[model samples]
Target: MKDRHWRTRYRVGAYEVWGTSLDSEERRRNAPHAEPADFGLYLDERWHGEEDARTSHFVYWPTLEAPVERALLIARIKEAAAALRDGATVEVACFGGHGRTGTVLCCLDVILRGTTAREALERIRREYCRYAVGSAGLENFLLNDTGDLVTPEPLRAGEGR
Candidate 1:
């Protein structure tokens, strides 16, 4: 948005996820290029009003239980990946656009870039913003690598398959 270089455009399955810290309505309106379609993923609990529903935007009520439910997280990643592959822009956001947002951004990176969650986390910090501090638990979950399908068991050694 505003011709600023994005942090990363990652593909998860068939979608793409673009990470950013802009949460203003004006910023959202002007963030993406005209040719590229855009969607918003708001990771805040306060925006969960039922009347605020939209086709292109999702509002998740994050908590300590988990920033996102596992199923929802998987679905969001898949959807974002599809949007990216289709040349659409999907923006993921959090309150300060750092911790929760950064966690999701790292998840997309791991899924699309084939980088370990740790590596992705490092990359985000180095390239995206120095303040990007994703949740350590979420980082571990992304790195678990229990294959494309999430399972109850922890990913065994070398068991990304």
Candidate 2:
């Protein structure tokens, strides 16, 4: 329906992550993935649609508002990362696919790669998009939450424990 904000998939080891925006959903059901992913990992700050709910194992947050819940966000990221390792597809997205989308993608990178937050941010910008993690506040938050290298623990579907 409009210009696409879908981006190339970033891979770490055996898993892959794709970043997208709300507008991109209208034009492609699964342009970035073949035959619709086994599942999705929706990362929109304030947007979730029927398709996402029905087909994705999603996590929601409002990136422009209150800070993201660090523990919960980490759990979700771990879950998605684990799913990816298990041969499932995960698509992380936000309204513009710039800030929140990119931030979460970097988080995934950290968990998967065991890199520092700063390093992940740099990698996201270099390999994904320059506009990624679009706010100083968000950047700071990520740095704080993931200052220590994060090693994501695998989480099962519907299990946040």
Candidate 3:
């Protein structure tokens, strides 16, 4: 929204993820041109919840170059994927709106649509952000750790923590 300067929107399976930058957050708070988020998955090394919106369920994920905590990553991905499937407008943002944001969105593609890690990653680069999944380590984690199909069915109510 606004000037399309900081955010790039994508549709993966049943969910819509807005890959955005911190700059968008600043612009949005000062004068919002788009609707507020129902959920936000923030993947960044430094930035936390500075623009906390009352309407959003924001999760801070400090990632990139960190060890692949598969359990935690899977949990967060599931939550964001579930929110997207439920038709809630969600935002996935990081420092540049390129790598980290792209990585998570690709993971959501795998969880929600049962896509392969390679397919998911390429999908993000082709459709969402061309230079996404920024870190080679991050990419390898998705390729190796994330099972081909982690969830066969939609998670039951209250399944995510």
lDDT of 2 by residue, 36-81 (tens): 5555656663455533422575555666432456666677777778
lDDT of 3 at 131: 74
Cα RMSD, each candidate: 6.9, 6.7, 5.9
For model 1, the superposed segments whose C-alpha errors exceed 4 Å read 1-17, 22-37, 48-54, 59-61, 145-161
The lDDT values for all models are 0.57, 0.68, 0.68
> Model 2 RMSD to the real structure?
6.7
Ranking by TM-score: 3, 2, 1
TM-score of each: 0.62, 0.75, 0.75
Clashing pairs in 1: 1-31, 14-81, 14-82, 15-80, 15-81, 15-82, 16-80, 16-81, 16-84
Better of 1 and 3 by lDDT: 3
The total of clashing pairs for model 2 equals 0
Worst-scoring 10-residue span by lDDT in model 2: 45-54
The residue pairs found clashing in candidate 2 are none
- Tell me the tens digit of each residue's lDDT in model 1 across 1-161: 22222324544445556554444454456545333336656677643441122334554646522445676766776676556666766777655566666766776776566776778778777766555655556556656742463224578888984
Candidate 2: which stretches are off by over 4 Å? 1-4, 25-34, 50-55, 147-161
